[model samples]
Target: MRRIATAVAAALALGLLLPWAMPATAASAPPAAAAFRQEVPRTILALVDLREEDTIRLSRIHTMVELPLNHLGLSVVYWNVADGLPDLSRYPGLRGVVTWFAGEPFADAAAYIDWVGRAMDRGVRFAVLGQPGVRLERGGRPVPLALANRFFARFGLRDDDGFSDLTYRSKPALADGTIGFERTLSGVLPGYPLFRKTDARVSSHLVMRRADDPASDSHLVVTGPAGGLAAEGYDRYFDAEYNRRQWIVDPFAFFRNAFATDDLPKPDVTTLSGRRIYFSHIDGDGWRNVTEVTPHAAKRVLSADMVRIAAIEPFPDLPVTVAPIVGDLDPTWNGTPQSVEAAKTLFALPQVEPASHTWTHPFQWIFFKDYSRQKEAPFLDRDGTYRPTKSDDHAAETAGEVSDIGRYAVPRAYLQQPFDLDQEIGGALDYFTRLAPAGKRAVLVQWSGDTSPFEDALAAVRKTGGVNMNGGDARFDADFPSITGLPPVGLPVGTERQIYAAGSNENTYTDLWTNRFYGYRNLVNTMRHAGAPIRLKPFNVYYHMYSGQKAASLNALVSVLTAARATELAPVAASIYARIAEGFYTARFEPLEGGRRWRVRDRGALNTLRFDRASATAVDFTRSTGVLGQRHSQGSLYVALDPAVAEPVVALAEIDRADRDPPAPVPYLVEGRWAFSALAGEGTGEGAGFRVAATGYGEGAMVWRVPRPGPWTITAERDGAVLWTGSATADDDGRLALTVPLSGIDPLILRLRPILRPSGGAAG
Candidate 1:
């Protein structure tokens, strides 16, 4: 203790205390913490052993309970009951204790018994998942002893039947002899590979329980009564992702039914449930159900304000440009309304959020550029003054133009020449915000393929306080996967594009990799994607609007979501998705000299922050003033700050900082200008600014920093012929700019041979 104090004092002398170290009067904790101050804990104590198989099983159990608990504003504080019961005096306010125990023989039985007795006296209830080995009485006669019998014996809730081969169907009051009633909710997604197209369209599974049992505890929030699928293929309890077998409910679909029926226990934890975001890209889907289902999804959302919702992200920049094959106002080209009334209804429900897909929706890389000699063309040729230039109709049609769906099988990236920040992200965002309902402001900024966006464009987005969900997270599995494959732990959501291309038809057009499937193939992908629900972290799903045009694709969509529901997968709102996704990557617990610095790069999961400073004051730099307090048990401190706001610094909440900087990410361009760091065969660039591959797969940029006061010769060639070339003096300010167009056949290069500058002026 003396050593710790001395070190803390020394660190303080060195100015290592973060801003959050100040007292509450200096700054406030986040709102979440403030809420904690006013209530008895809407929390439960979770006892676990956390051994091998238990980890996976426990994780699934948590997933199953997430929605119900979250809805009821309840949290669980885990205690390792494996060795023996830990002290719980600190958590006296906890509403109850729960475990998924089959009576794992434990040590210090006496102490556990005493703890349970005390807890029961304090009115702290007890619950378990499944049967957990309880003694059953048949016709008031004691049958046989089973594991965890002490628990049921103490509760005095007699059950006439022991664990039996019983099936509980999740239907509307169709009695199967279980406690309580919960109706099943089902839906369909047509794009995935797994789903029973002919027989069982709804993803279904099994559950195990005692025959003819009654509710064990009164006001017990959970009453498990599940059903078997009528379909033959999905009858048994198989974790299709891993091919594991056991007696349990279909983990994925169960949560969906739970959320839909509101059938689980009331929440004892607080949730950012209302804080949401929706991400959509319009590459043009068929109007069949998309036109119909768009309204259907909307109508479903309108009626119940379900946990899942949709927000439109149209390419509003298209219409204002020159006439072309597709116009901005045309639903096909985006930048237009799919349905004004739908938009109004969504906006009114405060359920819809709008995002920007740029005006022209060009390849996005080079289109925002300012051409040195040609910088004045968009304004000169299209308009006057200094407004950002709109891409010509040709810009919307060619190789380096807008993203044309099904244009290429494997989407190749290229440098967008003559690009500008204002034209791409800024202008689009501005235009849409004006057109959007006052309540439906957009927060998502999507790119053609989440290619390298300029740092400036990103900054402009952040200034509006929005996180960019701009990348692919994963691809669907083929035919079917019995087990789910987990995503790389460190990967952040939306930043990963995990692709698995298999189905009836697989093709690549422009930047899109399309794999269209039919009946069985769709079911395969659905089960495979749904198999490992735990592995589906860092979440984001994207497809061209075209693929979802038919039921061929939508089936998988339905299955994936249905699986997500049963597995307790919550589709975060676009408003908060970026933050939540990023949080997995950025959240940290830092040990400091005198204290600790706990920070998450994105909005954190509920109660993710639990420190030991009971009296410490915390302030969040992300967005909240912060609520500072600790849980009663073990002085565990959890902060209540806003989600996803960046730089949420916790003060006084930390012991101290060592003033260490984390290693930086690999060096890459922060600006829109691309500089090559390496080449395929040449190895590293050795400090050279750019590298080009023989196959023309690389990054290149032609950007100038300082302005020169003179006309300049500039040329851009597609093949053997020059696509564009011009000479003009720097307009007014003497600044020059350029963008390299992205293409497939040959690499575009800016050459040196001839800029004849007069006199002694140096050619930069």
Candidate 2:
């Protein structure tokens, strides 16, 4: 979704200082003298003008600026500047602040500039794109020039008393070719504020030149240790029509250079157990629709029932979280007795993680945040139909007055009663929990309609011991080419955060399910892009229950599952993914030194840490504690942390050293096809026996690198009863491979013991 806003330009040319330059390569950039020993360094504060920006979802900060930061494994906390500056001290993990403004500067310009100066004073970096808010007026007069110069001085630049409007004759040129990637700047550029470098340490990464003169060069993007500056039009390029936009700057390299993140440890939720995570989720839309798929069509079976039989029943190997709209299951609402039975049967499946999609689906959650009963009274009807009545009497009164009510003519999908946060969160989850089989509970609340719930709604879900997810709608493909289409882990709502689904649902793939019903099969393309080059997101098979309504849609849904079955993934429940996403915002990483080591704490349910551009590093098992295994992919090391251990220490050493002078025989996981966990080794040398647990469908396949090449026997038992006993010898690489037939969802305890042999080659 794209929104149009007024684009402001402040093309001032100030030559107040001497020009100097710094090296532009990351290799040449000097390291910070001291590490943030206690800081998390994951959250970036983004300032946007909500007046024109609407919400974070529609803001350029989230759609454009957040793309690179998210790819760099960082989350953004957006703040409306009109609300004044946020207290930076509260965010100890505050890595930096980025601004993208469209409207006039906030009322107080001195306060905004001083806030930036104060943030930089605390060792926090500052980056400004588009409007920097430096040029402002208070009570109809310009802010003091000294305050603006001080802001420019942070990036080692001085504002010159110059302005230019000859942008129609200017084009952007990269100062360094190595910094450019993918899209390049073309056509005439927009007018921009001009500055001269005051120090040699500041690097000019980009420049603008006049086509007519060919000699007038203005610094477009400059960066230093304190932060950087990306002039207007340099961050993103809008077409002449302003209909589409492409990144003119290599955001990955630019933000990396801007934030000095060459050695930062990124908390990665993209992978688990040394493999990319794969999960699936179903929204509760169209649950009552009847399936038209061949055999099911003649019987007039409910889409929910057909989905369970065709999708859930056949794929016991993959776990899918099924959230039913509470109103679709409760008989008092729009649900029938048959719908209730279908929901109960689906929740009983061991492969399904029961969840709730809210009591009555609120089309636009923000509409009810500050709901007014008197305002809604004229349009409301409580005839027990749970449907909105034709409000011809109040049509004119309600028309053009409602905001945040996306698409839907009414505020909610069902409107028999007034909106209630508790009912939508806790009440809905409680109803679903009762339908779930013994021991299993609703672990997550799937956001309905707009999916943008308020802070209280998220907090209510947390109160029910459940997590919340949806919203984000992350997708990256040919249509939505840039990583901008892929949102970060979640959005911060006051004290609570709303976790987003990893991938967009079928509704997006099928163009709102109106045409191209088979387009969902192309989801593999997004899965491919999100993994390669850099694994930015997990493999998520997200769709609506309505996908079962048509044969083409049903086939597309199965195609995605079949493709997932063929990939190397750690398949987990969607609730587990929500928890992992929650962990991304809460996990604290205390850097030990450089980026080689970190003391990770409070990483609840988050089980992995990734270090990019670390191909030469390997986990130093002897020096590290609470490590399960590590895998090197895309030139990055994915280290899986043991959840059983509290406050694990991850230490990285040279891979060459670990390979040459290998440590004593210790069984460590290499990779597995199933979800593996709770690995513990006992004894020493060849006598060591490792105990691990796993659960999955299909055939259970796994490999563990042992101390030496030799025969090993694996005894698998469930609930103290031996399920199977198998043995295989370690190969030249000391990799022990085992295969077991997994027929159910019960967790299996597997014990791997080295089969000792006599010196004569006989069994001992």
The candidate scoring highest on lDDT is 2
Best by TM-score: 2
lDDT of 1: 0.32
Residue 532 CA error for candidate 1 (Å)? 4.9
**All candidates: TM-score:** 0.33, 0.87
Model 2 TM-score, 2 decimals? 0.87
Candidate 1 lDDT tens digits, 1-111: 011112223323333212322456423545344232323334556676555235422353343433233323344456655455667777745656665543443444444
Worst 10 residues of 1 by lDDT: 316-325
Instruction: List runs of model 1 lying over 4 Å from the truth.
Output: 1-327, 330-349, 364-420, 476-541, 582-764
Span of 10 residues, lowest total lDDT, candidate 2: 1-10
List candidate 2 segments past 4 Å from native.
1-37, 138-147, 161-182, 211-215, 239-243, 371-376, 379-384, 387-406, 593-595, 657-665, 760-764
